[model samples]
Target: MTTTSAFPAANRPVGQVIVRASHVELYRDGQEVLRDVDLEVAKGEILGIVGPNGGGKTSLLRLILGLDRPSSGEIELFGEPVSRFREWHRVGYIPQHAVAFDPNFPATVRETVLLGRVAPRGVFHWFRPEDFAVARSATELCGLSGLEGRRVGALSGGEKQRVFIAKAIASRPDLLVMDEPTAGVDPESERRFYDLLGRLKDELGLTVIFVSHDLGVVSARVDRVACLNRTLVYEGPPRALHDEALLRTLYGGGTVTIAHSEEEPHTHGH
Candidate 1:
């Protein structure tokens, strides 16, 4: 493990427990973004959070990252309160949108991925040799080796997505939260990305929480699904969520269609 000598006092959790959010309520400017949200993810589980556009999926993720505080309730990571998790290295995140960087910026894929190790400004700007090894491993896992020297802007939508994924996995975080990771990718890329996720979960024992608007893909990929609409509507195995009536209740009514010969897939905000 790469030593973060800078934060020597940082508290590192022991054992396999990863993330737990309890009775979380998030309010923005007096309007509630999330209400009474309770969630938990153990190591090696790929959990999916799905809902309509304003359903607070992103808000839930932010709360887990400690980027935002819940108006009420508590969040715990590795048995410690989120407020006490000084080692931000244990968590990795991929936001819904691509990073806002100059298209012509001269940054190689490896260099960009190494940036993830840059701690708070006061810490050392240097990345240790182990950091490079981690980054290289992530790149190879994402099949981005040959493109390491390529400029960030020169990649396709799927390629750029892989770059971001590589960056997230570079540090070998115990938990990864990805929001709308396949938004712009083609079907083939999307399928491949999920396969990659499954492999990571199995090999690395990573607890993944991924949110997407596509129910078909999410249902096929994740071990379990949670329907969220400012609050958790359901939490159970994907097989139980195949009900058309349940889909209508969760998505505010839509023409339920069975994609890939599976039971009806939910659609919302159409």
Candidate 2:
């Protein structure tokens, strides 16, 4: 684990709990989507949730984001029960397929990012100088400085993703949540995207929670991982992915390729 994983597993500094789920269970349409899920994320930690398709990874995220209610159990955001949590300005969410805009959409990068502020400030309210300042900063941070006036529809997939991220961060949320943000991005773009996330974490001290199936990147970038498979299979440091039993339980003997650091990826059936 030490030879492969970059983050040290022991003596990790403890921070405030930003998200917590206890005994969470959800049954939708008579199908059990999640069961007995207990998860917690500390402030400023990058937590990755990984699972097979239809394994309740998104379901859990939806619950955490308060999009869907859990049938039984509790979820809290920033120590407040999710249902009672109303400080939405402190949270930013990028849903799955959030960047699936039509190629001909008329909104420019600046316009789209400005939308993030509309929710925090009333839609009826007019934009202020501070709003433009924040939007510009977010655009620049996302590397979309030169394309502020360019139509988002004309941008490439990776550029579109950055635009969406810029929009998400424009609100200056303390917690940034994303669902498969790298879905349509190319490999190079994915690398840059994670790098941007690292910058956001450092510069803004944001606590990030994202759902992804890209194990290679997840293993390398995240501080902790919660492997979901209709239940919580494993929760610990990225180094825990090396456990064959844990991988088998989470991936169910699927074709698993784990790349450790700059070292080559190793394939194992588990």
Candidate 3:
């Protein structure tokens, strides 16, 4: 595939670099999972990080979220170094697994989303009226308005995913990070989920950084794609990822195939 500019000129300057990793290297159990990785996430863009299993995708996310420190190099969030950054509320994170609620858990949909406010509201403080209003607004935004009172445990997998997304956006975060968000959803649900993300980016001016293995979804939805396999193999627009040799290098020479779409000329790596 031919390389095109990663972002249009108009969208490029919506905000400063929200996340930056410079020469980052990570090691676990004497094994180097990531080496000399450098990445940047600007405002108002959906960046998809794609790679095979054990490609340090989740490790990179953990470092960005401050859950783990890199073995070397540096990271910055919102122009502030990671070590000194204290504005955790500006970020919203949705982990790989769904919220594990018991079948009889009494939390309602609104209540579940309200948990996101705890960080800003203080753990020991009581919820204020604005907190409830924010949670309700997020619930409605995620298409769960009618289900505000429904038990979270009784919802479908797709609905559960929305609930988590609502929770992440409840704080009106500037950046939203998701790991394998569509892992358990059906194809239709996945499509709708990506559509929702696009809407969120336009309406909320939110910057999204997500880790996904689904090449079709990445190609169709994300603004930029980064292929990682111990290192960043390719970092550019999704359409630029048309080289079969590059795909083989990223996927470790697996039997790769490209599926094309009829409606639009796009490639899906497999």
Candidate 4:
């Protein structure tokens, strides 16, 4: 029986935050997208960011990953200012719509995953035997063991996601950040993806933060949920998603109707 206490974040001191955003605000083309956002993620916790479309979920991720800067505040990774943080090998990121890239790109699953090693091993370093070993292990962990030789272009959306995850872990990162990771995958595949992530977290002591539009995935898999709609509307336990009062606050007077079942996760509309 695995518990949250088994993870480093649960056992560590109260103040060991791995990621932090303090009073972060953003503006693109003179339009404010995010405002006064302050969040902290402890090591080993799987934190989910959720919100309505155009809620700045992806925008927040960019700041956290250092892909974009905040207009008015600070963002930190591994306790260092994201601007000055240079230990990038310790981070693994899968951007939003990762599978939307060109399908004609010619690269096998193994070869693509091996590319992750380049960032960690240095661009000038030749591929070592251990790199292959690492890639193989990552494939197995992501359930891509048999598809190693297959062209990534030929794989389905779900399969491509698995290959990308394999590549992300190939670098053996301490923090894994994903933006809308399961966007186009089916329900069963989404469940399996989160399951794989749970296992990876336990085995690797990884800290996970991701943007998820699916409320069910956040409720079922994440340690905490941050609700954002241009700003932080809520940040607490996943169970709060079911609170009608909270839903009203988050959705801004729109009627929210939740429809759920055993197989597929239907959305709660606002």
Using all chains and alpha carbons, the TM-scores for the candidates as numbered come to 0.87, 0.91, 0.89, 0.92
Between candidates 1 and 2, the one scoring higher on TM-score is 2
Candidates 2 and 3 compared by lDDT, better number: 2
lDDT of 3 by residue, 90-164 (tens): 999999987444658788898899998989897789999999999988888888989988999899878889999
What's the lDDT for all of these models?
0.76, 0.84, 0.83, 0.84
Q: Which stretches of candidate 2 lie over 4 Å from their true place?
A: 1-13, 261-270
TM-score of 3: 0.89
Among all windows of 10 consecutive residues in model 1, the one with the lowest summed lDDT is 1-10
lDDT of 1 by residue, 1-270 (tens): 111121121222234667878899988999989987767676677888887889899889888889888899999987889998887877888988864445787888988887766652227556777778888888899888899889988787788888888888876788888988878776677777887898888878888988888777677778878778887776666654576765665667876553643233334344
Error of 2 at 26 (Å): 0.4
Worst 10 residues of 2 by lDDT: 1-10
* Better structure of 1 and 4 per lDDT: 4
Root-mean-square deviation (CA) per prediction: 9.1, 4.3, 4.0, 5.6
Best by TM-score: 4
Number of clashing residue pairs, candidate 2:
1
Q: Give the TM-score of candidate 1.
A: 0.87
Lowest lDDT block of 10, candidate 4: 1-10
Model 3 off-target regions past 4 Å? Answer: 1-15, 99-104, 260-270
